[model samples]
Target: MIEYVARSGPPEAMNCPAFICDTCRNQVVAEGIVTWATTIGRDGDRGPHQQTPVYVAHKGRCGRGLELWIEQHYPAADGWIDLWDDLEDFVCQLTHNLTNAFADDTEGTYHPHRLVHPKERR
Candidate 1:
């Protein structure tokens, strides 16, 4: 689980409104398909309950909305540029990128998730 600290000097939790499907806006967990690449913690009161290698819970809008928000707010970040109509594609890309970053596979070889986008599926 990633912790957010406010610039004002208070410990705060990070919440991304885009992660949840706009319709539900309920809490849900996302998991990585690749075991070695990435891992996300489980949702619980204890904060990041499990160190599982495939699970991230988000609330707000779906991946597509989240991608749009990311592009608008964090333009420099090229991670979630392509929109995903299928949630499965979104999950796959999310896990792949997260796993690569978490593993610190900076060699640009091992993970190589750089330019790959959901559109490539087409």
Candidate 2:
């Protein structure tokens, strides 16, 4: 997993669009897939600034094989640029949350597991 803030330049200089997860195909707004904030400057001299904090991973239930899918489909030759960090902070935090949730062992509470493939299920 990787986490970083992506900034887009002025309207004329804007190149890349917002990051979309390959697993979801931008169909749903899931966590760690597409997080952004738009700020309109009051000066009126510059266009609205968009800052997107992306958290990508390949092990999560929500988005597995996202990185590989993106790599194969959206190669850098087509103007796709890799702009994520090496640290898997998002995955680490997800694991930590799951560990804590399961450790609680609270009654009437549900702990969701990763999505399993139908063929892999026994």
Top of the candidates by TM-score: 1
* Model 2 TM-score, 2 decimals: 0.22
What is the C-alpha lDDT profile of model 2 across 1-122, one tens digit per residue?
A: 23233557775544444334535544232345422222223245254332223534323654445544444444445333334432345447667887576557666444232332224323
Candidate 1 clash pair list: 20-60, 20-61, 21-62, 30-56, 31-54, 32-54, 37-99, 38-99
Task: Give Cα-based local distance difference scores for all models.
Answer: 0.34, 0.40
- Model 1, 76-98: lDDT tens per residue? 23222222234456557767887
After superposing candidate 1, which stretches have Cα over 4 Å from the reference? 1-25, 29-61, 76-108, 111-122
Lowest summed lDDT across 10 adjacent residues in model 2 is found at 34-43
Query: What are the TM-scores, per candidate, against the unseen true structure?
Result: 0.23, 0.22
How many backbone overlaps does candidate 1 show? 8
Tell me how far the alpha carbon of residue 119 in candidate 2 is from the true structure, in angstroms, after superposition. Answer: 29
In angstroms, how far off is 7's CA in candidate 2? 33
The alpha-carbon deviation from the true structure for residue 107 of candidate 2, after best TM-score superposition, in angstroms, is 52
